[model samples]
Target: MGGGDGGDDSVLHFVFVHGASHGAWCWYKLTTLLDAAGFKATSVDLTGAGINLTDSNTVVDFEHYNRPLFSLLSDLPPHHKIILVGHSIGGGSVTEALCKFTDKISMVVYLAADMVQPGSTSSPHDSTMAVGEEDIWEFTYGEGDDKPPTGMLMKEEFRRHYYYSQSPLEDPTLACKLLRPAPLRALNGADKLAPNPEAEKVPRVYIKTAKDNLFDPLRQDRVVEKWPPSQLYILEESDISWRRVITLLFSLSRLPYSLIFSVLYLFFNYNAKLHSWFDHISSLVHYIKKSYC
Candidate 1:
């Protein structure tokens, strides 16, 4: 993904927000790819997530968990606007950012993420919805079992099936080792954001991971229908892991700027099909950025 627009225009910076139970570490491969292509990328570890050193149990609400992101946006250069990319529940963080820093963000990209609309209290696929009552993970925050869960960590046995069913074996292996307990209240119990017309003015893009087991594909369709994005692309048969779905997001260059479509299944219909499409998709890396920036 070589990302120069053939001119001296300001380089497009993509600020990546990872999903639940994840940290800045998850975006390692994507950040490297963007940097090599001449684009700037910063992946922030939300409070208690990644290596932020905050305790998840103490996180009281969404605002508290999202403090790091708010700080990062607050400190940006005045004229520089970033393309905010959120994956899974990270979409909630993106929405929070949109409400607070609409001007600093040029576009919001939701990758297999919760495109929670205004007035909605929680994500379409919150922790409870994603895991259900199955003994797939453990939830605790030092409080008694009677109280609501404050943090959660997925069980190793169920991790592969839910999050990385379609990804390479190594991807899930790495995630299983590195995944941390996410703050439950911070992710699911946020108060509804008051309507902000400015947030609507900013362009939004939703990239669906059709094969994602955690966030149902049908729910993704409903989200798109509810708040239609400027662009929508679906990664067929790809799981939530970047190893399988990152190429599809990186391949946005092939799409025409003026074309706003409902659904486009662009890559990896089956195993071994991704390489054939990569050559074409990677040919141009800054189509959307070049047009927008």
Candidate 2:
């Protein structure tokens, strides 16, 4: 997906937020693809992520972790709107934005991400998190020697099995090196998310990774069952691997500037049917970017 609009006067812009243990670097591949396709994309490093280097231990709440993105969004030109895409725990960040800046967002995309219900407790064994093959992985809470109620880090050995299992081409060694300890308290907070009265008015789309070991197909369904977005697109992980997953999500990158009501589902129903939709989406995005930029 083209993530940026290249400062095109009328083109669409995308703000990408990475998931837990992942920094803005995780978005490099997708952002590069988006750049080639002509969209202006920006990936933010929340506190303690990417190159930001905020100590994970100091992140006491979501506000600390979410400030970078929130500050970036605040700088956009008036009348400017964005398609906010969040992956994994990043979902909670975008969801919070949806409420605070309702009129500024065109759409909210949760990509195999957490859709946290404010003021609720979550359990892995609960129906919401139980949909996956979660048993295959082991998790450790807090940084080593750091007390309880801290960030969480997955075992490096299981990184490939859980995080990148759906993307077979992903080099676990490379991914492992980039992973950092996530501020668990930031992701698992007890504070209530600001209720967005306009949430239903804004279009929401969820793209599910079918074979996701971390968030199995059933787990994704549980998220959908809770939030019930405007539409759902399922990407089958059966023999598809990373290429297929990227292709499915890429379709969204190209539609940055389409009219919200007119373009919400332009690529939705057909994503599962067209294996090459990624190419076409890129072409369309280039055309749109060219026209506006």
Candidate 3:
């Protein structure tokens, strides 16, 4: 059954966590889709990224770097449970958060990300350092010869090859403009993503990027082998950003998380002949709810 207005507003509240050198701004398209379909969505920018004022270098570990996300999770309404979606390095953040806040989370979705475990010693300090030509670390210009390290910013030049290689040519230009310096320790330091009972309690899903250059498909598969999720999805897109907005719509078809009629409305919000539409799609939700689960 739908919410009071026959809308899917409360079926699930989604919180999107972005990957390296990115921020909440990355989920623009997905938020538009969710808004149209009557779902609540939020994208979090970790410290030192997006509009946050924190210095990245000061963030010595994952806990401090991703404090914004954990804070958001902690502050959601007492009864509200979020479906956390982590992209790339953000997956590691999700892994850590689950240990402390599983009760507030309904599901976890890893989107072509580095799924780090508690004792992961080789997950790399950060993907931005290992992959691509930009070498975001190269942009480490001295704030002052005398000042201690605050954090390193990914230069506008390198973000394209490192992040938006698959997105629209212009998207990289725009996104890079908003990029901020991330702490070196976020990737290199110890962040206790150590497996916890709370984290194990929630259902999880993994989406593999078949043509991903950053994490690579093989490594993504290996992460899955290390700790399998409740469900797995594969995304095939040459331009990853271009594919990101639409992939969720396609991937969600099999989720059975929301009623089919609700989703049909997302596609055809057109008016007229409403009765026929209702007649055709109503039973599907019931059948799925009864037999599929």
Best by lDDT: 1
* lDDT by candidate, in order shown: 0.71, 0.66, 0.65
- Full-model lDDT, candidate 1: 0.71
RMSD of each: 5.0, 5.5, 6.8
TM-score of 3: 0.75
Q: Candidate 3: lDDT over CA atoms?
A: 0.65
- Write the residue-wise lDDT of candidate 3 on 153-245 in tens digits: 656565666566677777777886787766666655534455475577587877776766567677788788877877776665543232322
TM-score of each: 0.79, 0.75, 0.75
Model 2 TM-score is: 0.75
Report the error of model 3 at residue 31, Å.
Answer: 1.2
- Model 2, total clashes: 10
Candidate 3's C-alpha runs over 4 A off are: 1-11, 124-129, 132-136, 139-158, 238-286, 289-293
Could you arrange the candidates by lDDT from highest to lowest?
Answer: 1, 2, 3
The 10-residue segment of model 2 with minimum total lDDT is 260-269
> Between candidates 1 and 2, which one is better according to TM-score?
1
